[model samples]
Target: MQLKSSEETASKAELIWAITGILVVFFAAMLSMNIVITALPVIVSELGGTQIQYAWVLTGLLLANASSTLVWGKLADMYSKKVLFQAANIIFFTSSLAAGLAPNMEFLIGARVVQGIGMGGLISLAMAIMGSIVSPRERGKYAGYIGAVLAASTAAGPLIGGVTVDTLGWRWCFWVGIPLCLAALVVVHTKLKVPRYGTPGKIDVFGVILLVTGCSALLIWLSFAGTPEFFEWISLPSALLIGGALAVIAVFVIVERRIANPIVRLGMLRDRTTILAAISSAAIAPALFSCLLFLAQYFQIGRGFTPTEAGLMLLPVVGGNMLGALITGRLITRYGKWKIYIVTGAIVMSTAMFGLGFVLGADTPIWLIIGALIVVGLGFGAQMQNLMLVVQNTVPVTRVGQASSLIAFCRILGGAAGTAILGSVMAVAVGTSAVAPTNGTNPVYAEATGTLFLIAACITSVAVFTNIAIKEVPLRTTV
Candidate 1:
């Protein structure tokens, strides 16, 4: 009995330390992503970059992150996740240092792309590692903690960026997460002890090339379409770009089906729940990323608030996300049901997005805007991690890394695509090369933002149907 008890105690300690390490890595990755939100405007301006370049700063990272996620996910199934995670940490901090030293928008964007490659590993591996260590039934308890870290890091990031921009410099936004990244690396190396499954398979090099090329083509088209200096939406360039991208992606799909060890197993996606979750994730991601990226611009440029004040204004989002995630995670754990929260959250998100569309303006009341932001946060928090939890529960233990990372890849892809499309829309609407005028308040920019939210609302509504259509599966009790 004493021996059994001691084994249990040791196991518990291991679990605690492992979870701690995962959370630290997760927090650092999320912090790196968010810390650039508030400082981006200043960074773009100081670097003499146009609004299109501003959007690329975000899109570049997201594109790389999206493109690399499946590769990392597949690799995690074959390699030691611990070593890969540490390698990713090194890449992220090194690129972050490079980003801080960037003298031009092009260099910063390039560095951000490298950072995203590391981020892709960190994001996918974190969940993959968690799914290995924790059972689905128990995951809600820990997933809530992960969600809280996400919320905390997200909340802290803009504020940190704001303060850093105000005092030290905008470059510090890229630099601030390095210490946390190093700390996470140390913790993960010591505590993460998951076993590797599966033999090393041949990577689908051609498929990766095709996938990246297709996505890059699509995103480039989106970013420049309808701009004065670029091709019009209905032009030959648009048609060729769109048509060529589609052709390449279609080829990628074909290759994935034939490949023995596909980067993204299209067969896995044939499951009803997995496919629906992917759709829901893809649909909702734009709203989440849009709010994070564009709201800062609206607050700073359209409403003429300082970075600090803008960051403070976003606190409602943080509060709502924290509460929504915590409550939903606990409830799902207790009830062993998840579909209800996802459907409800999707509905709430769509509703809030529409509300923002109606309420946002140059002189819109701060209280109304705050209310909308809160609702948006709540909806996103409830759905984000739960979607992955459901998919992980459905898949076999060996495929957890693939399943979790597939969902993440979809989310980032959607965010990247949405940011580009929306950025273009804003540029056209404002009738300027930049999203905002250099000098004063632009009512047109405010109106453009309102339109953007309306589009986001429309996109998010797709998730409501997808989530509602998702068949509920009971949470698994074993890892």
Candidate 2:
């Protein structure tokens, strides 16, 4: 009995260290991704970039993150996850250094793309690693910790950026996460000890190339369309780009089906719960990403708030996110019911988004806007991690990495698309040649934000039905 008790204690200690190591990496990665939000306008102006290029800074990262997620997921299943996680931290650290020193807009965008690749690994691998150790039934309790880290990093990013940009300059925003990343690397190396699950297999190189190519083409077209220098929405360039993207994606589907070791197993997606969860993830992602990204711009440019002030104003949303994640995570663990929270979250998110649209003018009451943001955050917090939890429940432990990453890929892809589309919409609303409204308050830009949130509301509402349709299975009690 003493021996058994000792083994249990050791196991618990190992789990604690493992989770701590990964959460550090997770926090750094998310912080790096968001730190630029408040500083983007200043960064673009200093670099002599256009409104289109401004949006590309974000979309570029999301695209790389989305595209590389599957590769990392597949690799996690085959390789030593501890080593892979460390490697991702190195990549993120290096790219962040490069981004901080970038001499031009193009260089910064390139560095961000590389940074996104590292972020892709961190995000997917963190979840994959968690799935490897914790059973689905127990994951809900731990997921609260993960969600709290996510919320903290996300909330801290804008505030950090705001402070860094105001005091040190915009470049420091990129540099701030390096220390965190290095610390995470040290912890992960010492603490994370997980067995490699899958045997070495052929990676689908062609599928990756096709997926990246197709998605990049689509995003580029979306970002540039309806701009003065680019082709109109109905023009030949649009047709060719859209058609070519579709053709490449179709080919990718075929390749995945034929490959012995596919990056994404199509068969896994056939399960009804997986499909519904994926749809819900994809649908809700845009609303979450768009709102958070654009709100920085709204506060800084629309309301004439300083970066520091704008960051402080976002606290309500962050509070909501933290509360929602913590509360739902505990409840799910206790009761083993998930669908209700996600569906209700979707409905709440949609309502908040619409409310934001209605009250988003430059002169709208601050209290009213804050209330809506809190609700939006609450809705997002409930759905984000739970979607992956449901999907992970359906798969065996060996395939958890792939299943978790697939859902992440969908969410990031949707975010990239939404950022590109909504950026274009705002650009069009502001006039094709208009630069980013960095100079001062622009009513045109402020009005366009309202339109952006309305579109986000429409897109997010789809998740309500999808989550409702998701059939929840009993959470597995064993890892």
Over the full model, what C-alpha lDDT does candidate 2 score relative to the true structure? 0.87
Per-residue lDDT tens digits for candidate 2, residues 209-241, read 999999999999999999877779999999999
Instruction: Give each model's clash number.
Output: 0, 0
Each candidate's root-mean-square deviation in Å?
Answer: 2.7, 2.6
TM-score of each: 0.96, 0.97
lDDT of 1 by residue, 119-196 (tens): 999989988988877778888978888888888888888888888888999988898888988888888788767755
CA deviation > 4 Å runs, candidate 2: 1-10, 432-434, 437-439
- The Cα RMSD of model 1 versus the native structure comes to 2.7
Once model 2 is optimally superposed onto the true structure by TM-score, how far is the C-alpha of residue 457 displaced, in angstroms?
A: 0.6
